[model samples]
Target: MSGLKRLLKKGLGLGDMAFSAGGGAINWFPGHMAAATRAIRNRLKLSDLVLEVRDARIPLSSANSDLQPLLSAKRRVVALNKKDLANPNIMHKWSGYFERCKQDCIAINAHSKGSVKKLLELVEFKLKEVICREPTLLVMVVGVPNVGKSALINSIHQIAQSQFPVQEKMKRAAVGPLPGVTQDISGFKIAQKPSIYVLDTPGVLVPSISDIETGLKLALAGSVKDSVVGEERIAQYLLAVLDTRGTPLHWKHLNNRRAEGVEYDVEENHIYNLKNLKPKRRNNPSNRCDLVYVEDLVMEVQWALHSTLTEFNGNVEDESDLESLIDLQFGALQKALKIPHKASEARLMVSKKFLTLFRTGKLGPFILDDVPDHTPVS
Candidate 1:
């Protein structure tokens, strides 16, 4: 058996896994991202208000630290987008946490009409004083990639148009699932009555990602491309996170028919019976349970890879053979994952499905960030 197979078979403890939180850093700073940063700095002077969007599921990690200085000079509003995908209780705590910091924050589901109404009300309340001084308020929308910046803008425009039928119809900003879709910074006029304008900027990341787990969370949320971080690696991190939280993988939630033949039955409520596993001691064990059994993860990966290979007329006997075949057919596996083949591909198709399930909210609502009880911000 290969080294990985042996390790998997031995059931290496979660802490022993190579992709632990303290594991090697995961960094991605493309030239385009650097250029976007410079562009944001130059354009900050044109706006009076800054709307910073962040993924509600991973609020702290999704907030880019690089833009803090630029945003600090202006009236700022933090919109935690995609609240539907996050835990409501935790989100409530996040709102209070931000409030304690004296920040104007609102949780919103960009697709919801009611939520968008609350967002507009909050924006108006925050800028009421400034709007009185300057009739036209330039609000700049900024965030990391795929945080729903464009969607938020479109929602605001729709609300403004419905409120004022005589105003000129505004063009919709382009949107896509993948990160870095908005490549340029462009301004759109939202409200004609108040003459409110919004500048939509490309999603930008800091030049360096100091936290490995934060980067992984960003990748899992689809803020960064899978190519920057191997699919298998991301899957491993997902497994670890779910395992830590004692959350079931819920394979049935995955729409892929290819996973039917796996050892896990589609009708089962949870993927693995991890209750029998030994619990890891932690300073705060209130949230997490025992670490996930390595064997379960290995089995899931093997079954997924085998099923994918079968589609391509390829076969493997066990985890050891599966690794060898993955090495030879890495490009084919990448195609199965719908990503471009790279020289160092992890070639685990199951990882893509696992991430897709989480991103699509099929696995269930999760608050990836840890939130403890705290006094409400006065």
Candidate 2:
């Protein structure tokens, strides 16, 4: 009965609607957002205003700059969605950030029709003069997948109807993950008269990288998943990092192979004994602890390369010494992990360049091979 009421209210545009509701705690931007972006670009020339929605919690991380091209000629209204769930102080800072960027910013919960109307009013105010000479006006709504385009549509329709009922409120929701080929893209329209067209798009799901600890760090962080990097690999990586760090505890506790009366403490003798320790058992498939550690370190080296390249500027005084820098940070892993210097070294160089392209958005969809479609849970 409640669900039916929601459907009816949604049809009539009478009450609150669910916009883009993300299904998982960990969210990632996938094919849906990419498709929506393309659709938005195709329609930009036909529109006068672009309404961008973003999550307030991680405002900077959530905004997609890929739409800048479509928005270059179009006026923009930024609606910070889900403000109710974010820190108020953070929202204020973000609002200022958007305003500084010259974007008309409005912090509002997508479920509130009053707020939505206020947003529309702001959009109108920004474009009223521009559209005065035109017959129709176009307003493009953009956001990540599951941000709330569907609910906003219902809210706008309900407000237009001007009929508020006393019955239990209906809950509106997003229609699908991606925009369909149907006339309505998400929930937006293209108008012809001094009219307004709203474009419905998928909510952007930003990729999450919180779960990407290398095997060595994963053992310390305890987030090693057997599916990706098994327990054995993780254990091995921990031993390796500790080895390089001159820590003896990791080697001492290898598969219950503790020295007859030794402890996992930081003493000089322990360190000395650790240097002499070797895998007691040979080639046991069940005890693949060492491999895991090496893999984790290699992942770290890859990230180090990626980050360094990302932070690089035009030129440095000793720019040619970067290869040595790379070796210094990851040389031990290369030696211990038995990863050929060439294979891993090449990836680092490639990843560094890749990150540079990624940050500038020049390498669109290229990093997709490794990055997941959705953000991972922290």
The best candidate by TM-score is 1
lDDT tens string, model 2, 263-287?
Answer: 3223322111211212233454422
Candidate 2 all-Cα RMSD? 20.6
Each model's TM-score? 0.68, 0.43
RMSD for all candidates, in order, please: 13.0, 20.6
1-378 per-residue lDDT for model 1 (tens digits): 533333234332223322343443445677788888888888788778889999999988998887786786678999999998998867888988887778889999998889989987888888888876787878889999999998888888888778777877766888877898888887767676578888888999886665666777888899988888766666655644543333433433443533464443233233333222322336645222212223344344434444444443322334444444444334443443344455353445546655665676645688887654664333
Off by over 4 Å in 2: 1-34, 163-193, 204-378
Stretches of candidate 1 above 4 Å error?
1-25, 249-347, 372-378
Give the Å error, residue 30, model 1: 3.0
What is the Cα root-mean-square deviation between model 1 and the actual structure? 13.0
